[model samples]
Structure formats: structure tokens, C-alpha cells
Target: MNSPLPTAWLEIDLSAIQNNYRELCRISGAKVAAVVKANAYGHGLVEVAQAVLEAGGEWLAVARFEEAEQLRKNWIMAPVLVLGYTPPEQVVEAAKENIRLTLFDTQTAIRYSAQTSQRGMTVKVHIKVNTGMNRLGIAPQDAVEFTRWVSGLPGIEVEGVFTHFARADEPAADTTDRQIRIFDEVLASLRSVGIQPKLFHASNSAAVFNYPQAAYDMVRCGIALYGLHPSPETLLPATFRPALTLKTRLTSIRELDAGEGVGYNYRYYTSKKERIGTIAIGYADGFRRVMGNKVLVNGVEVPVVGSVCMDQCMISLDGIQGVQVGDEVVLIGKSGGLQRTVEDVAKEWGTVNYEVVCGMADRLTRRFIHSNDKKG
Candidate 1:
């Protein structure tokens, strides 16, 4: 293991992650598929995957074939489903590794079928039906025929059928209900033709909490498993605990004169004599430059002063008395009565929690801390 770095680091609570997984399963009343794509939303893929399995998750889903390959190489033998496209050239190797691929087109399914036939092995695939999300998957109108074509292919095993919700997190349900109706129509068409995949899943994190009916056979828990609601508009039970805590120590503290400016371009000037705390983290560490003026510190919400540097940022400490050098600065996490969640930070960046967490870079060390471990 590498020694801990002295600069900013992320603390991931493994037990909290497990708790979130179990709670999602309990709420949805369905098998849970731990979505570990984007390195488990930057919480460390292998670590989070292991924790999900320990929490009784039935499957693991990733967005890339490389991620599935990496999991296999690391001896993660649990079922891994790639939720996105995989090149036809890699189909045979993917099958050999026992990684499940999402199939949405007949051409790609034929390629995979041919590869599996050559190897004398069956490749398991999940049929992705596009109910409403226009980003991927075959259109719902074509899903029944596509499923039939794929199921009859030489070596293709239709082990699952799935779809994605476009706006399950929204309070309004017209669009989501329409998508579900279309998906159900496709499923009924397939069953009428005597084709039924063993697994049927359509619920993402948002659907898991809000639209339990979409949790067909397994619920894919991505953001929710990390203890973040899909959107701030969502209100889930309080059992979900956020597992990632981003922190940096105060590298330097200085008292500034009333007219003195801080950081690049003099964007911030002290209205009066003020204490400024410089933290050892900045945009390079996935702390977005847009977050320069909004963040949390020492259990008090504080404004970041001036421009954010590549490696550091300054925060005004005028209202926070007695904060000294080497104090732990929380960018995202609870400190005493103050909690800065990823959703709050995302609002500052005008994005979502998924982007906020996935944007976290790898240069900073990740310190995995168990909930049961007492801090020294």
C-alpha cells in the first residue's frame, strides 16, 4: 500500500456504502445491481464493488468493457454487466471473460453471436429497449423484433431485458409512465412470441426510490448506492448515508488588511481586516473553478475568496473565529452541525451530483475508512 499523501484526500466510508446498498434493496424489494461505472462514481470501483457484494447485491454494472475486464483481472468473479457499447472485435474476449454486454442492435448482436459460435460458448446479453431516453438502446417499437432476432441467434443468450427512465426523479410522472407503458408493451410482445429473458430490469437509482414498479428483477443502484439522491428534488428515507468525504488541511493562514486583495485577478477584496485560510486543493483535484466562491469550512458555510488556483484556493475566515492553520477544511462532508453534500456542490457548478463525484481526480489519495473504525 502507498503511504498517505500530505495534501487533500478523500475519505470513503465502506460501511456507509454497504448500508446504502442494503437500504436500496429493502426499499425497492428487488435484487440490487451495484452500478460501479466511472470508478464507482469516484469512490473507488473495486472497493465499492466488494462492499456492494457484501451487502447482498446480486449484480454489478459498468459502462465500459475495460471496466469489466479490469474487474475480472482483479479477481472480481461476480456478474458484471456493461451498460454501454462494446466494440464487436472484443465480443469474443468479453464472452470468454463472462462479462455480460448490453445489446440494442441486430448487427451487433449478430457479431456477438458469430463470435460466441466460433468459440463454442454462449454469450449472455441484456436487451436494452429505448423507452424514452434518446441517448441509447433500440427504440421500443423495434425492441420486440430485436429481442426475437437476438434470442434466435446461434450463440446469443438473452438473459435479461432492460430500459432506462428519462425523468423518474421528477415529481411529474406522465413521461415516465408513458415510457413504462411502452416498455411493458415490448415485454408483452416478446412473451407472446414465447421469448422471455430470465432477468428484466429498468429501474435506475431514481426509479428505485420513486417508481418501485420499474424495479423488475434487479434495481441498478448508482448514485443512490453512494448515498446521494438522483436529484435534489428527490426526498428519500433518511437511512441513506453519504460515504464520501472530501477534506483538505489549511496549509497557511494570514490576516489581510482591509484594502488587500486575494488570489488571482483581485476578484475578492477584504472589506475589513480579515483572516484568510488557504486550503491545499483546487480545480485540478476536481474542485471546480466555478466553486471558487461557494463552499464549506469548519462547520460553517464560507465563501471562497478570489480565483481558484490549480492546486489551492482561499476562503474568507472573517466570521469563523479561532480557526487556525492546519484546520481540516471540508469541501464535501459533514463537520459538526454543518454538512456540505455533493448535491449542494453540484448546484454551485450548475450540474449534478454524478458529475461532481465522477470529476474527482486520482492524484489525491483516497483514504478508505470503515464506519466502525474510531478516529485517532
Candidate 2:
């Protein structure tokens, strides 16, 4: 572990993660392949991967080869997949590390034929079908031909076939259904060619909660495992809780008078005398300036009375008492006597719920918290 920094920490609830893993399995008919990419959505890759493994995750996925390498460096022994672009040149090292690669093109597979030859003894791969997302993966029409040529190649294991969903969160249901239909067709085409990749997956957080029909041999649980719904109304089982909490110290307290302005451009002007608490975290620490619309202090919703400077923001402590220096200020997570999950931040920011808590970048020191003080 690195030396602990004095900055505000994001405490992660390990127990909640375990609960989410169990709940994900209960809802998903297939086994779970937990997506731990983007450092497990900024909760720390190795830590969250370990938690998911402990909670019974069989496969782990990252968006790139380096993330898999990092996890392997920490001795995380599991089937780690590289879901993003993997240059043919990197295939040799990826195979050596036993990392799985996703293939979307026959040419890319051919270029890595040498690595593929050696990889039979070392690595495996999944074939990604574009289906309807059209972002990555082999086009549905060509996926069969692509899979056939690669399946016969040396040093290759046809591990899985998968697709991404584009509109799973939109209340209108037609688009997600269309995406699923195309994906099922791709699977049928693969079976027609006598190719049955062992695992098949089609769920992001949105689809896993809303569409159970798409879960094949596995489901990729990302944001949901961190206890965040894709949207407020996104259907979910009752067991999940958010694993991350963002908190900082109140650096100092200041008395303000009526009509006094605060922060850059003076976005807020006090209407009456009040106590203002300046927190150490600001836009520099991953709390977006857009979130200034609403934040909280001691369970009372408070206005961030400023333009939100780089390293600090102030919250008005009006209609409250017992203001002091060094008091705890929670931007996300439970505090004092109330719970403020990232879903709250997403609603306040009017953006995807994943981006809200994932907004807590790695720059912030993550101090792991537990269900009680004794374990901490």
C-alpha cells in the first residue's frame, strides 16, 4: 500500500460490495463477470476486484491490457479480459500474462496469427459482435465468417461472444430490444457454424437490472456492483448498496453578514448572517463544479455558495448550530445521521449515475471504511 495522504478519503463498504455481488448473481441467470475497468470505476481496481472475487465473481474484465497487467502485478489470479482495442504487438505479452483478448476483425486476428499460435498454450479470446451499438466489435453480418476463420487458427480458444447495448437506460424500450434481437441472431449464426464460445454476455448495469432475457452464460456488472443504479428508475433487486463515500474536513469556519458575496464571480450572495464552512475538496478533487447546484452538510441540504474554486468550496450553514473547524463534510456517502448515495449526486447533476461517483478520481486518497468503527 502507498503511504496514506492527508487529503479527504473515499471510504468503500466491502460488505455492501459482497451484498451487491450476491444480488447480481440472484438477478442474473448466468454466472457473473464483474467489469473492473476504469479502476473499478475509480474505487481502485485491485481492491474492488479482490472484493468481487471474494464475493464469488468467476471472471474479471478490464478495458485494456495494462489494467489486467496491473491486477496481475498485485497477484490477482483470475481470468482477466482486455475488452478494448488490443494491438497485435501487445498480444505476446498479454498471452504471457494469461490475459484474454477480444477480437472484432479477421485481419486483426490474422496479424496476430503468430501470437495466436503461441497463445494456445497461454491465452484465449472472445469475439465481440457489433450487433446494434456500432461502437466496436465485428459487424453482425460478418461475425460468423470472422469467427469461423479464427476458430480454426492455432493457439486460440474461442472463449466468448458479446455485444454492448446503447439505449438500455432510456425509458423507451424499443432500442434495447432491437439490440438484443441482433445479438441473439449473431449467437445463432455462431452456433450454425458449430462454434460455441463457452461464455456469452450482454448486460451493462442498465440491462442487467432491466432485461433478464439477455443474460446468457454471464453478465457484466459494472456500476451496479458498486451499488449504483444506471438511473433512479432503473429496476433493481433490493440488496445492493453503494460502496464508495466521499468525505473531507472543514478547514475553517467564517462568519458572514447579509449581502456578502463568496467564491469566484460571487455566484452566491448571503441573504442573512450565517456560518460558512470551507471544505478542502473542490473541482481539483473530483467534485465537479456542476454539482455546486446542491450539496449537503450535517444531513441538511445546503447551497454551495460559490463558483467552486480549484481546491475548495464553501457551504452555507444557515438555520443550523454547532459549527466548528475540522468537522466532517460528506459530499457522497453516509454521514452523521443520513445516507447520501451517488444516486443523489446523479439526480443533482442531471447526468448518468455512473459518472457521478466515477467522478471521484484516483487523485483522492481512498481510505477504506468498514460497517463499524472496530474493523476500521
Candidate 3:
């Protein structure tokens, strides 16, 4: 829609996105609230949000007030609930924009109500219960009181009750069951206080796949919508495709002498005189400097002979040839016959798949490509 994009772009198959959403829906049999936060995990939120909705997603979720604003400005008419904290000052704008806020305490809702009513508008709010994640959300015991207090406040709607799971993605998790038990307890507590929120939800991508019962009225799925299983145990009958691919061009190729040191600290050295190519990507591009001295190419993985630099990293390609200047090098995403999934890299990095996708979002210049347009 704007100017011509660069040749090296993160090609997103919108059709794949749609298929994955539908597949996720099928597997979970729950309404999908595709999480498009973190710029849609670096897949370009506006474009990915549009694609998801077009493919039959009914609700959207973001983590920040400004992200919701950007989506609203882009004409995303779905119900968008911000899953993170929002300050009192921004409550009125959240109301005016029809964005929702997550309430971890009664004061946030009360403050928001005061601010929103002064502006002659109301904002829908979800009361978050901290079961065991120990991150955000109010304590389980306090959730009901907070919900009741917020529900009765002017210019605020207690539209939902939710919680975060600590290990829903893990196989045979005892912890998530406890979290859900707590969630149900809070939901019942809300009813006791006569605060019947319109929506009851607590499932993320992991819960959607592994724990279906957690899908109350809606399920918020981030990584799953982008063609990734949040955990290996996440059961899905439908095919999902990874939406983002990070590719860079080879800048140069050179030879290294046998036994010569390579990279910082000499982490890798040549056993023999070998050919090497420096690719135009490095830790600066979110390619983890720790991926040090390791490269995957030509369906055969190789080692990185040195420390990763800021703007660039060198890959050893001894037997691998036919790679000249500008040969496509896939640091992440799919490239040629050789492919490395985000899950593959995340495990190597001692991180989650969510982190890997978010990693790509943080590292590269994202390009959006809408591959399908069948509307809902």
C-alpha cells in the first residue's frame, strides 16, 4: 500500500495465518482472540490482525494501550482487550478508543472510572487473578473484591475475569491445574459478589492446545496464531505454518588459514584452510550473539568460526559452495530446502517459542504480505 518494499523481506503467508487460526479454533473448539501484540510477534500487527479477522477471528488482544490505538486507527473493529497494566491517566483514551484494560487491583479500576467518567466515557475492564504465575494480576483472594468494586464504578465495565497459567504448555502439568482451579474459584467468587462478567477466560496458546476446558468464552492465542505450537504437547489436528522468515544476503566470501583464530576470544578456529562467508546479520538483528559460531546451511548445519559481531556475523561454508554475493541466508524462518523452525532455535536458546517469535519481532525490519483475502 505504500512504496515498494525491499527484496529481502519477511514474507508472511496470510493464507497460512488464516489456516492456522481456523485450525486452532477447530482443535480447541473455542472462540479465538488472536493476540497481535509485540507488533504481532514481529509479523506486522496491522497486516496480521487484518488477515486473522478476515480468516474468521472474532476478537483481538494487545498488551499495550498504544498498540490498541494503532489497531483502532487501522480500522480493526473487533473487541480488543489490553492484557497488560494501564495507568490512570490513559483510562479516558482507552474508553474513547473502545479499548479494554486488565485490572490487577481495585484502585486501577477506581482511578480509571474517575478519569473516564469525567471525560463522559466508559471503559471495559477485565479483572486479572494471579493464580501462581506471580507476575501480574491481583491475588486470588482479592480478585472478587476488586471485581465488585470495579464493576459498580461509573465509566467502567467489568467485562471479564482472567488469569495467566505458569505451565499449561508443559506435558502433565500439576501447576496449571492449580491455576485453573484458582481461576474457577475466582469466577465463582465474582458470582457470589453479583459481578457476572460477560466473558470468562484464562487460556493462552498453551492452554488452548493442551487444556481445552480453560477456554471459557474466548481464548487468547499469540504464538499459535502465527503457526507455532506453544509447547510440544499442544495437540492440534490442523496444519499451522510459521508466518515470519528472517533472511539476509551474503556480503562476502573469503578463505581462512588452518589453525588461525576466528572471531572474538577465538571461540572457533579453522582445522584446515577453508572458505567462509560473512552474512549481513548479527546479534544486533536479534540473532542472539550466543548463537555464536553456529550456522545452518544447505540442509547441513555448520559452526560459526568466531564471535558474532554487531551488524554482521560470519558463517563457515567449507564444502558448501554455489553461494555468491547476495545468496539467501536464512537466520530464521524457511530458506531453500533447509529449514529451521522458531521452536528449534528457541530450545537452543533455553527460551520458549513465544520468546523466539518475539525475538524476530525485536530484531528485524518486518515486511507484511497478505497472501489471502477471503473475508469473515
Number of the top TM-score candidate: 1
Residue-by-residue lDDT tens digits, candidate 1, 1-376: 4346558888999999998988987898988899999989999998889888877766999999999998998889899999999988888888888899999987788788888898798889999989989988998888888888888888888899999888988956689888888988988898999998889999988887777778888888899899888886786578989999998888898889899998889888898999988999989999988644565676788888888999999988877877778888888988879888898888878889999999999887888878856756
Give the best candidate by lDDT: 1
Give all candidate RMSDs, comma-separated. Answer: 2.0, 2.4, 3.0
Arranged by TM-score, best first:
1, 2, 3
Query: Which sequence of candidate numbers ranks them by lDDT, best first?
Result: 1, 2, 3
Clash number for candidate 1: 0
Using alpha carbons, what is the TM-score of model 2? 0.92
* Clash pairs (backbone) in predicted model 3: 293-304, 294-304
TM of each candidate vs. truth:
0.95, 0.92, 0.90
lDDT of 2 at 348: 73
For 1-376, candidate 2 gives per-residue lDDT tens digits of: 5345555778787777778888888888778888899888888898888888987888999999889999999999899888898998888787788899998887788766776575455458888999778789988888888888888877777788889898787756688888888889888978887888898888887787778799898888888888887775685566778788888877888889999998888888888887887888888777888635555577776677777778888888777577577777788866567777677777777777677766776778876655634564
- Flag the better candidate by TM-score, 1 or 3: 1
Which of 1 and 2 is ahead in lDDT? 1
Model 3: CA > 4 A from native: 1-9, 235-238, 264-266, 291-293, 296-299, 361-363, 370-376
Local distance difference test, candidate 2: 0.80
Cα shift from native, residue 129, model 1 (Å): 0.8
How much is the lDDT of residue 340 in candidate 3? 77
